[model samples]
Target: MTRRTLHAIRHVGFEDLGSFETPLRTAGYQIEYIDAAERDLGQLEPLAADLLVILGGPIGVYDHDSYPLVADELQLLRARLAADRPTLGICLGAQLMAAALGARVYPGPAKEIGWSTLDLAPSAKSQPLAALRDVAVLHWHGDTFDLPQGCTLLASTPLCRHQAFARGPNLLGLQFHPEVRGDRFEHWLLGHASELATSGLNPVTLRHDAKRYARTLEQAGTVMLNDWLAKLKH
Candidate 1:
């Protein structure tokens, strides 16, 4: 039997693959990462993957002038969606996915910087994201996406309407950080302390709640990861 391949695109130095790496490794998928900040994405193709996970980053999707790789990465994502392969985009990755699909990505009402509850859309009750009904996920984004044509809006919060969306059977974009765990969250909080001040959120408060939310978030991530894998099997 052939092992599945998972292409993981990393956008920054600190944003490494977190909890999602475990299940993919356990399931015998070959995980390969391309660092978008340092590497040229034009030479990198999104093909040969049973799954593709575009991880989160500190940069905005529209900041292509500073991060020139953004355009090529978006183009690659567009091609992947056209091929109809299994793809998951988290946070900034989700915004890029939305932009590639012809949906506008712009600043949201306010930066959602900590744990917040997301209400599942009525239609999501029958889909893989149904597990998210009234659940709180780690949110750290300031940008949100408009629902792309033909895609189902799965989850939302007061701050962002397009919290999560699914395109057909195998594509998902989540604006929140479902893949973050204790250590990873700590790293992010410590690394991006300056941004917390800009967003009017206290990093100390986020750290205080990190320990409290870790276990629950991990459990929720497991459920979501299992659901994503199940969808890929079809």
Candidate 2:
């Protein structure tokens, strides 16, 4: 059997594949991380990989003027998504996907930065996100996007209505972080410590919640990713 290639566009070192890595490997995927800061996204062929995943980052989609790389990523995503190739986007990645699809990406009503379960849309039961029906996932972003035209809304929360969406069997976008690892929860807290402080959120509370829900989320997130990969239109 030939192994499939999975290219993950990573904006940061720590925000990586997490629980999704094991299932991808078990599914016979050869994973490669494209560090957005060091690599040239425009130079790479967007439709070359069997699967392309855009990981989360702190930057906003509207920051294209400030960060030229945002333009490169947008171009890459636009080309890949136009082909309807297997693609997944999380958080900032999701926002970028929406923008590429002609939707507006901007700040949400509030910054959702904690553990919470999604309110699955009726259409989600028949979708890959059904694995996260009642599972608590990590929410660490402040940006949100309008649902792209013709995409099915999967799951949402009170703070954000467009938490997740799917254009087809090959495309999925998640505003929350289902790929976050509980064991490495501290890295998140430490990485975004300043943001937490600005939001008046206490790390002690998040630490306690991570202890309570991280394991459960990890298990559920793995299930979700595996289920999605199985149903991918490859």
Candidate 3:
């Protein structure tokens, strides 16, 4: 089988594709990392890859004036999404996708950190997220977005209403960190130590939850990603 290109827009080093990497390779994708900070997104073709995944980050969507890379990503996403190419966005990535799709993205009422189970929409039971039924995923984002027009709401939590949304089979946006790996989870705690401390969230508690829930999310996340991949419209 021919290998397809998978371009992942990574904002930070540790926020790389974690559990999704192995499955993507097994499915014949040659992965390429486009570091949003280091790479010139202007030089990169928006729709060049078979798949584009926008990874999670600490940046907010409205911070484009401060972080010019946000503008580049929005421009890139608008082009790719206009063509309806296969795209996946996680956390801040999801917020970016929503902004690109003409939806409002802003800070939520409260920071949703730690592990929590999602309330999947009834329709989501038949969608790719079905594998995540009752599975607790890591929720590390503080920002939320409005449900984009013409997108189906997939999952939600009490804190955020638009936890996950999909536009047909080609586009998906997840507001949580289902892609986080258990072994490398320390990176998250240390990397966002300031944010955690500011929120009065102890790393010890998050570490304990990771031990309990990360493995389950890893398995369920793999299944969800593979299921979504199998159904992609080429």
Q: Model 1, range 77-124, lDDT digits (tens) per residue? A: 889888887888999888988888899998888888888778888978
Give the runs in model 2 whose Cα sits over 4 Å from its true position.
none
| TM-scores of all predicted structures | 0.94, 0.98, 0.99
Which residue pairs collide, candidate 1? Answer: none
Better of 2 and 3 by lDDT: 3
Clashing pairs in 2: none
Question: lDDT order of candidates, best first?
Answer: 3, 2, 1
RMSD per candidate (Å) reads 1.5, 0.8, 0.6
Q: Rate residue 112 of model 3 by lDDT.
A: 98
For each candidate, the alpha-carbon lDDT, in order, equals 0.82, 0.92, 0.95
- The digit string of per-residue lDDT tens for model 3 on 15-128 reads 999999999999999999999899998778999999999999999999999999999999999999999999999999999999999999988999999999999999798899
Backbone clash pairs for candidate 3 read none
The candidate scoring highest on TM-score is: 3
